[model samples]
Target: MSAEATPLSIHLADDAATALFGEDLLLALQIGDCVALYGDLGAGKSTLSRALIRALAGDPDLEVPSPTFTLVQSYDLKIPIAHFDLYRLSDESELDELGLEEALAEGICLIEWPSKAGRALPKNRIEIHLAFAPDGGRTLTIQAPEGRLSRLRRVIEIRRFLDGHGHKEAHRQHLTGDASNRAYEHVYPVDGSARLVLMDAPKRPNGPPIRDGKPYSQLVHLAEDVRPFVAIGQALRERGFAAPNVLAQDLDAGLLLLEDLGEDGVLDSEGRPIAERYRASAACLAAIHDKPFDREIVLPGGHRHRIPDFDRAAMKFEGELLLDWHLPWKRDGQLATVEERTRYLAIWDKLIDEISDADTSIVMRDFHSPNIIWREDRDGYDRVGLIDFQDAMIGPAAYDLVSLVQDARVTIERPLMDQLMADYLSLRAMGPDFDESRFLKSWAIMSAQRACKLNGLWVRLKDRDGKPGYMRHLPRTLWHLTVAFEHPVLAPLRNWCIEAGIELPESPA
Candidate 1:
């Protein structure tokens, strides 16, 4: 990390604004973070720290007495934090005596008057300086190390960006994110109306080339920035689809201010899949796929983002994730031998092009339940709102249709899947060139390929990334793959599964 990285600065309008700033800071705080707060007496350092601690504890009314006398106030919250008052310390050595060093290693530490501790502060700590304003507000200057606090820096940058764009006093509330590194916040304006979603999708480096000297992301045409999102989103909205309106954007920085699609989705209160919503979502896919699209889309500022084709190599890479990640994890480190590996690749090599699209229509890779927001108040297809479609590609329309009916996250009952597929096909029948048999075959092939990818991806998320939340979906993935095999197009995949000793879960009777 370079010391030359720019520092972040933010201005506060009042005490409430300072508290809001503190909440924003806490969004980036993790265990082992040391926030060195520097400010003069009554400069609202403690006030900001108090708000941060309270937000972490999830108690707005939690009493946070100053630790001036105690020197340290420890909270037994979700992530244990230590609040330290270094004002009365005699020298830097007192930090050790007060166990501040140990607390820094154990949990997050917020230190007021960090200058009193002098050089004892951690080198990678986030440094914040506050100053009094004549209007009784505060000015906060924040400096975070480049790599460690990159997300923190991006959060503040996005906040300031929004502030400059008519959301200066918008209140931010955290929204649960997916397994990806992206984070979202619901931004409510000061007037308490018109909420927006702030997407803090910082640009990430492409990993080392995994196959054929190309990174997996590049190979699969994964979205590396917000441009694909903006382009694909505008294309969808322009076609009268329910893709969110991009209120504002910072494409290079991977930040976006998007319209809040509200909390309603294609799921019930108990979180089961809603049949009506799923049918409508399937119809939405029909509407999108039936249209003609171009590989290259022109975006705002005269910039062009070309949608990549889901070609032969991309399909092969996805299919191999089952062998590369999931199979090894499932076998407890026992990997496929050279023969099994050859057979797996050979099968995909033969069938890849059969399922692969030839730059047909946009296939939003993740058109599943979780990404579909069901706005009941909207008219017609608008009720099925789309989110998380940044990784759009020019693929077979059947791909997104398979994604909708046979979702990885939710169990679409066989009847529901059948009904949704029927609903979808009926809509496509309205078009002139709809080839029913080929499209159904595409559905089968795409469904099988998707199941294989999900199986491997969920396992990779758990075994490689140390996230076990995806384990619960493994059975469903296998079951979906088994269902796909009922179609003759996936016979090769079924045979390979048998040869590799990959047990397909039995279909529900």
Candidate 2:
């Protein structure tokens, strides 16, 4: 742990000692600001008021007297302000007589014992509570509107700067023994260095991510081919996508230290639905394809192909795994006929051709539900983040869209899909080449390819790893395949899968 990584705690002791605490709280004051100070007598309420007035006036001597029986003490400061001690006021009339509202309209006003003023004070005000600590110190609690959280963050930054340094071991103590096994373990301090969060991998580390009997899941070791993943994230961020910034990476060790976006993603706490987070995600996709990605940037992920073409052989080979492993081995006691397997391969070939020559942009190869993180703020693409982006490539523009709208993990409401697509089209004048008639055909073909690919992945995860829970997604995957195969343009392929006994699972299960 380094001193820079230490947590922050907002501590204040006495009114006369406010200068030693720092300028963070004082600098946060502004025009039309009403601050309600809460504390018992000798709790440093007047002390804080004096520090605030001196701060605003650029007074080095801190020449400010107690208002006590005088009620209000006016100050000719850099911002034309007034400091009032309303602790002695017995009635609301005394507050009105102080001209608080008038002063607020023209300049900054700092009010002590503001509760006595009641409705006379503005609702949009800062509230500060001071309490004596166990060791004769003071703790201050500041509250403001949600919009001010950013400004407050800035104040926090300054406070940290003034504190010199903090206890180093406190940060290192947070790391668990299992931390190295996960990707992205970040330590960030909060609450003025009083607490810290050790963010692990964004997604749960299900089990050891070993491959081929070797522990290959560590993100620090990067194959040369995988290096492009970092560049793609940088590019997407430049274009405005909620992609995670790489905090640190040890490519040789396959370890990646990354920023933690907290526990916010498309899914809600109840695990029921992924609504209220689709709009921004849709916008990000729209933005990616809004302007043709700079042709100069080299696309990454696969070596055999780039953004414009599909690896038909790879798709065909992957599609066969679905039947070879997932479907009942003996579909009611006999192997699938050679004719059936060949026909499905032909379907894949045709669909690949349909999108092979289409317009291309960056396609986050698996832009499905799990890869997206939801936020209702500006952090996400609008509040939705794009994760699992290492496999991104330049491919058909429809690839990512179909992946998002027709996700196999979760079914999206049809109306929502309609609105998202309409929103996308309004932003992008797609092109004469991408008319509705052509788009539907291309969408069906792409959806078919995606569905077939997912079904194969389920089989691989299950038979190869004994992970059977993934079987649940099979039915939904089949439905998407069915939708694609049944499209008017894909009717021939649809009938062939049925005749070949593909045996797609029953959905709505």
Candidate 3:
């Protein structure tokens, strides 16, 4: 806001004219920085003016067409830079009438053709003059009091667009798919509410690739899904579910701070074993199942990727991955013929169709041991907290049941799995429909789908993202697969894994 600030110079000799304007605008400014333009028509004033506005708006290709008729076109820059083209001003007094002064007071302003409003302008405004040359080239002169154009000048000298600071730097240092990449974890000071856990999404570097890799990519790095996750978290809290309260989200920065669960998870506080506590831990899952949300909430991309219908192909691929990577690798290269693979796939397809046709319910896809945290408030054993459910979906209720009963981390005792299922059905008041025989059959089919997909995912994770530690969980996942496949309900699939030579672990819970 001071005219004493310094002004930086940039050369526009070659095709670097537009690039110079972009670089200058992005680097030299923040929200609420103001700029003024001075030039003749076709003097390249509009060209440089457009570039500057686009940079602040987070739109490098933003088309800031002259507001010939509108006179003023306000822009909501990533910060807040506004652009005004006053070529159509009927008179110099028209400037004040248009409230141009107010926009300047509120944010950084860019005014084109300042001469049209000469005496009506501010006292300490920066001025840029563009005049035509004999050869049709334009000479631009930027003049301001010593401090007037300081920020804009500084931006022009920046070596990078974002200039790489704060959250941007954190992302570059942290974001990665590498297993060795330590999970970006933080413990926050307790605020009167339940303890909170905050996970900083690994910060990605500045540029185009942030949006390119796993799910989707874009020039922007904001976590597009954070909004829905926030909505669901709020909804769950309203329902009295044990989901952590999402405290705050800097979606543009992919940062979320959540309420922390205590050190005690389903596994253990120190991650050691406590055999006697197993039954109660398993019962906590039943408590969650008692409260199912039936409302369909709008998510990012609207509902294109809604559950059940959305995850069907992904679900089928989960089974296919078992056949594609894990099974073939486990067999040590004993290959199957094209016809044999086709026939085996039909079995998985049939099972998936049957499960999909079942009554749909909210399915917490990763509702297993690692996700549940223990809390002391709801009594030691029943205080299980759920996390890692950014991918919740609508599906057969049995899917998440299998996630817990046939956990990937360890096996559940047959008696315990049966007891948990019985308890869950009873709590929900479904005595007749929750028949043991029918429940177990649904559980087996869903479990097989989850297990195969999980194993396949690990393989893909290792091969694609360089995260090899997930491969260790593959053996247990195969054990679950074998158990589910062996049931008469999944007998056809069990025979496929057997003939394919994928070894199933014999470990018992």
For all candidates in order, the CA lDDT equals 0.84, 0.60, 0.59
* TM-score, per-candidate, Cα-based: 0.86, 0.55, 0.56
The better candidate by TM-score, 2 or 3, is 3
Worst lDDT 10-window in candidate 1: 351-360
Residue range 1-509, candidate 2, lDDT tens digits = 01121122367655545543333455545567666777777777777777666656656477788876787877766566777888788888877788888788777776777777767666667667777888787887766665443345554543343233332222221222221223222233434443332322222233455444333222222223334455666677777676777654433323344445445666557654465566667777877776565533442333232322235544555566656655543264355568767776776777677766565677776676677776655653547777666556556677788888777677665677667667666655554455554556677777777776677668767667667777787877777787676578778767766765676554434
Give the per-residue lDDT digits (tens) of candidate 3, residues 1-509. Answer: 24544444444453245445543454444334445676666667667767666645546577777877888887764456666777777798887767776777677777787677767777677766666655545556666766546545533322221223111111111111223211333332323333334444433434333223433212211224455455556555666666777655554444566666655665655654344345554555455555666455563445433332325555665567666666556667555678768987788778877665464466667677777766756874337676766556666777888887777765566676667666666654552344455555777888888888788778867767766878877767777776776678787877777776677767542
Model 3 error, position 419 (Å): 3.8
Model 1 shows how many backbone clashes? 0
lDDT top scorer: 1
As for lDDT, the candidate ahead, 1 or 3, is: 1
Q: Residue 269 deviation, candidate 1, in Å? A: 2.3
Best by TM-score: 1
Candidate 3 error regions (>4 Å): 1-184, 187-196, 202-224, 269-284, 298-311, 331-336, 356-359, 379-382, 413-415, 428-435
Instruction: Report the C-alpha lDDT of model 1 over 1-509, residue by residue, as the tens digit.
Output: 12725876677888888898888888887778898898888888988999998888878899999999989999988778999998888889888988877887778999998889878888888888898877777888878777656767766787878878888867676776787667888888988878899887777678898878988888888888888888888888888988889888877777789999888988898878999889888888888888777778898689999988888778878988999887788788899899888988887786766754422588899999889998978999889889998899887788888888888887888989999989988998889878888888878888888988988999888877888999888888889899999998778779889877787988532
